[model samples]
Each structure stands twice: as structure tokens, then as C-alpha cells.
Target: MPFVVPRSPELPAATWGSYGMTTLAVVPLIWRRRAPVAVLAAIVLIGGVYKVALDGPGQPLPYAGLIAFYTVALQCAPRVRVAVGLATVAAVALSVGWKTGTARELLFTLFVSAAAYALGRLQYTRQAYTEAVEARAAELERANRIEAEQAAARERARIAREMHDILSHAVSIMIVQAEAGPVAVRRAPERAEAAFEAIAETGRDAMAQLRAMLGVLRTAEASPRSPQPGVAELRELLERVRASGPRVSYERTGSVRELPAALEATVHRVVQEALTNVVKHAGASAVDVRLEYGAESLTVTVTDDGRGPGGSSSGGHGLIGIRERAAAHGGTAQTGPGPDGRGYAVRVVLVTSPQEVGT
Candidate 1:
């Protein structure tokens, strides 16, 4: 607050003028944030005038100059700060004459002015650093939350696919067996007994698979233990369909080799879904299925002369499901007319090697 070590006596004749000058310099500080540089400039100019016009030589001291220096230090950039601080020091030093013995006051002014600038600079730097750290923490928290949501979505999709595959295939066969039970019972009890047994088997299989999936959701520690359906189980799937309806024939073009579990499952699902559509939508009496294995990939095609409008095939989620499975494995599925142009056909091609879809 005191720039001079020993205070200078106030000029009695100009006491009111001195009070006016101090008020003009310090009061503008309330609006410093809006016009910081302007306020500092006004105060500095007024301090110089107060020194030369009112106080006279050998009596110069910073009544409000110290406050101005600190405000400028915090608000201005580095270069402007240096200019304002140095100019302030020089203003105080040059105001006093060399003949006067006020060397102590000059030295005190230099130390106080430099100290004010340094303190203000320190406050600015600390505040800036704190804000940067808080902003970085907030960004990291947002990224982690987004990643958690994505993981949850993927899990839900997996469960949906599992339920669809298990229930749709098993339920389709069971429904056919159930409907024929009454008719077969009237003709021959022997055939009706076999159909009843088949219905029970399919229902039991569906229940077991459902339990496995429910276990996974019950707890992370209790995961799905049963082996999932794959290409190896295609025979069972085809046999089950044969017992139901829509005669399906299967043929292999190349040697069958071991493949990824997910890839095998994708193949099985595509064919199973295709055949299910044949049983439900297609009025065709027979369906043809083929699996072609190559060095780089595998291809499967299912065709049937189903009696339906052309739009039903693509308008449903069935085609989308087939395409998603193929594309997930870096492959594709296409649907159009059959080889004979009399029915709907679905052909799927899958690359042997796994490729990240969106990485």
C-alpha cells in the first residue's frame, strides 16, 4: 500500500485535489474486467499528473499506482505486462530529482512494483493450470461412459440373436409335428407316437438352450456352458426340417474343414433361417440347398418355389438378418429369383479369415 518507506507529507493546500485524483484512479478498478487496459491506462496517466502537478519534485509516491500495476499484470498478455510494469517503475524513478535525498523511496518503489507484478502473474498461471486439468478429467469421464454404453448394446444384440435362432427353428418343427399329431393318430397309432416323440424332443432342446442363455445373464460367473450350434450340427438341423415339411436336399461341393465357431454358427443360422422361411412362406413342395467350400471362402445357397408376392421377401427382417450375419464376417448375402426364375433364392458368401467390421 505504501510505495515510499517514509511517508511524504500531504500538500495541505491541494488536499481535496489529491483526494479527487486517488478516487478517479482506484474507483475505475470496479469495471476493470470489461475494459482492463483502458482502466490501467487512465490510472497510470492520472498518477503521473498527480506527481508532477500537485505533489511536486522529491515528493512522488504511488497512492494508487501499485493497484494499477497489479490489475494490468493479471489481465494483460506477457509483453504488455512487461511494458506496463517497467513503465510504472520508470515513472516513479524519474519523478524525483537527483539533488533530493530520497534514494530510499526510489528503491522502495522499485521493489514494491516488481513484487506486485510477480504475484499477479503467479495467480494467473495457477488458475489457468487448474482449469486445464479439470477439463481433461471431464473428457476422460465422457469417453468411458460412451464405451460402457456400446458394450451394453452389443450384449443385448447377442442375446436377441440367440433367442431368435433357438426359438424360431425349434418352434417351427414342433408346430408342424403338433398339427399332424391328430391326423396321424386316426390313420395309424404308430406314426402318431413317433410325431409326439419328435415334438417332445424339440421342446426339450429349446428349453435347454434357453436355460444356457439365461445363465449367462444371471451372472458373469455363470456363463453359457452348452456348445452353440455350428456347421457340424447342420445335419441335425436338416433332419429336423425334413421331419416337418418342405422337402430340403443338401449337397457339398468341397472338403469340410475346421472353422471358427462364430463363422460356423453364422453358416448354420443363415441356412436354418432360409429353410424356416420356406416352411412358413413358401408353398413350394421342395427346396434345394448347396454348400460350396473354396480355399478362401464358403458359399451357401437355398432356393424354393415359394408362392408369395415378390415384395414379401425383402420387406421382412429375414433378409436383413441374413445380410447382417454375412457382412459381420466380411462377407455378403444376396436375394433374387431362383435358378429357374420360379421361386425366391438366397445366396451367402463368407470370407474364411475374420475382418474387423468398423475398426
Candidate 2:
């Protein structure tokens, strides 16, 4: 058997019908956010004409037209907005005759539409401005984070270079003294005793420089010592390491100038760390250290003659520590066999003026 479809119940007439239709027109306003132009156009075409057709003394459809007009004015571009405003005024003028329409009614409708439009416009402008501000803030934060990462990398490299320079020189001196200590004692006990004394003094100096350089790695609060070290201290570091065993040499290529406190610390740390690694890892050997201070940046290199300790193949705590120090200052560290194919070499480069550190 075929089933019959039910029809929608008929709407009642009177002020109620007009009121219901007016309410139906207002429904489109909810879609104003998604499709403002379309909703406004539909309300104007349907609601506007309905009010004119109803032409009764008290029709509610006019209120729907006012709502549509307000939406158009607020959401549409200036040109379209002006056109919508004119159209709304014309609709009202036509529906309510010039002679019969009271001045009070006309003013009230205009005032309501204008008020609604102003409110909608204020809301839209505030939301748009807020989003733009949030986006810009996020972008700045991202840039700052990237810069911080780069600085940290550089600082680690500097520390590694310093360690290599200090250790390589110290170990070379110690080895030479150790070998000569026995020979000199057999031949001349006095000379041997002097050599041993020199060795002890050099060890003390290396320890001091190592502490100072390492202190920079710790947080400011953690490190109570003042922040500053430069090429001047490099000489003392070289002397101590030289006494350890290896015959070491140092040369400054460019005009050495005072550097920023942080940078000075960075340079000292790099040389210190590099030398430490050389003494610990490289066997008995000779080492050479070079420092070049250019207008833009500084470069340090440490080379030793001990048999290749093999590339630092796996990253250990020391390597990680070195890397962290370099990154903090926007520098880099690289370790490998020396160019002469005998021992390990470490090189570090850093900018003189680094970005400010984060709190």
C-alpha cells in the first residue's frame, strides 16, 4: 500500500503571521558571520518586499528589514555598505508614504539600524585587531628562540677550543718533563729537581685556568667569580701546558683588542677546553695554537703531534658539554685528526658581539 506524505501546518494570520514572518527573516542574521553578503541580500529581497506587501498599520516585517540593513552596513565593504544603506532608506520611504509616515517612526528606524551597524562594526574591528596582534607576538617569540639556539652553539665551540689548547699544551709539557726527568736525574740531579718543580708549577696554573674557564659554563649565580678572560690569560695557559711536556708555540695574527666580557669568557673557555681534551686524549706530543682576531669575529685552532686518538666518533659527556657551551654563545666546535696526519685538532670560531642572554 502507498503511504501519504503530510504537509506543513498552515500559519495563522493577523499581527501574529506578520510577527512570525518577521521572526523567520531574522533567522538569516545568524548566518551573517559565515555568509554576510548572501544573508543580507536574502533578507532585503524577501523581508523588505514582505513589509511593503503587508502594508498594515502594525506590521512587524519592517523590523526584519532594519536588521538586514544593519548587517549589510557593518559587514560589507564601504562601497557595498553605502549602496545597502541607500536601498534600505528607499524601501522604507516607498513602503511608508512621505505624508502618512510620521517623523518619529522614520527617525527611530534609522537610529536603530545605525546603532546595530555601529555595534557590529566595533565587534568585528576588535576581533580582527586582536588576531593580528597575537600572530605578530608569536612570530617574534619564534625568532628569539632561533637566535638563542644559534648563540648557544657558538659558545660551546669556543669552550671546546679553549679546552683543547690548554690540555694539548699541558700534556705535551708533562710528557717531555716525565721523559727528561729520569735522564736528567741520572746525569744531573739538580737540573732534574728544577724540571720537576717546573712541572708542578705548570700543573697548578693549568688547574687554575681550567677552573676559571669551567666557571663560565656554570650559571652566573652558580659561578661566583667575575666574568672576563682574553688573550692575555692565553699566554699563562700556554706556559703551564708547555711545562707539562710538549714544546708549544702561539701567534696572534690580527690586532688583539679587548673583547666583551661574555665573548672574552667564551674565547678563554674554547681554548681551555680544547687544550684539556688534547692533554687527556692525545699522547706525548708537541702542539701549536693560533688565535686570529678579525674585525667581525675570532678564530682559534689547536693542533698536536700525538698519534691520532681517532675522531671523537661517539658523543660523550665531554663532547655534549662542549657543544652546549658553544651553542649558548652562537659558535661551533669541530674535532678531527690534525692536518699533519699525526694528532687531533680542534677549531672554534665566534662573533665578538653576541646577542643578549635570556634571563
**Model 2, 166-247: lDDT tens per residue?**
5555665566677789989999898789779877876776687788877677656644555456667888777766655567
TM-score, per-candidate, Cα-based: 0.75, 0.58
Candidate 1: segments with Cα more than 4 A from true spot: 1-35, 38-74, 77-132, 220-226, 308-315, 354-359
Candidate 2 has a TM-score of 0.58
Candidate 1 local lDDT, 1-359, one digit each (tens): 23335345773443556666666667777877677667777877876777657753333346456666777887788888777767776666775443353988778768888887887788888889998999998998999999989988877876787787778778877888898899999997897898888889889988988988898788758454567788888888888777776688898888678888878888998998887777666666778889998777899998887764462273256667788889878898988878667788889998884444232
Task: Evaluate model 2: give its lDDT.
Answer: 0.67
- Residue 11 lDDT, candidate 2, scale 0-100: 31
Predicted structure with the largest TM-score when compared to the true one? 1
Candidate 2 local Cα displacement, residue 215, angstroms: 4.7
Task: Estimate the lDDT of model 1.
Answer: 0.76
lDDT of each: 0.76, 0.67
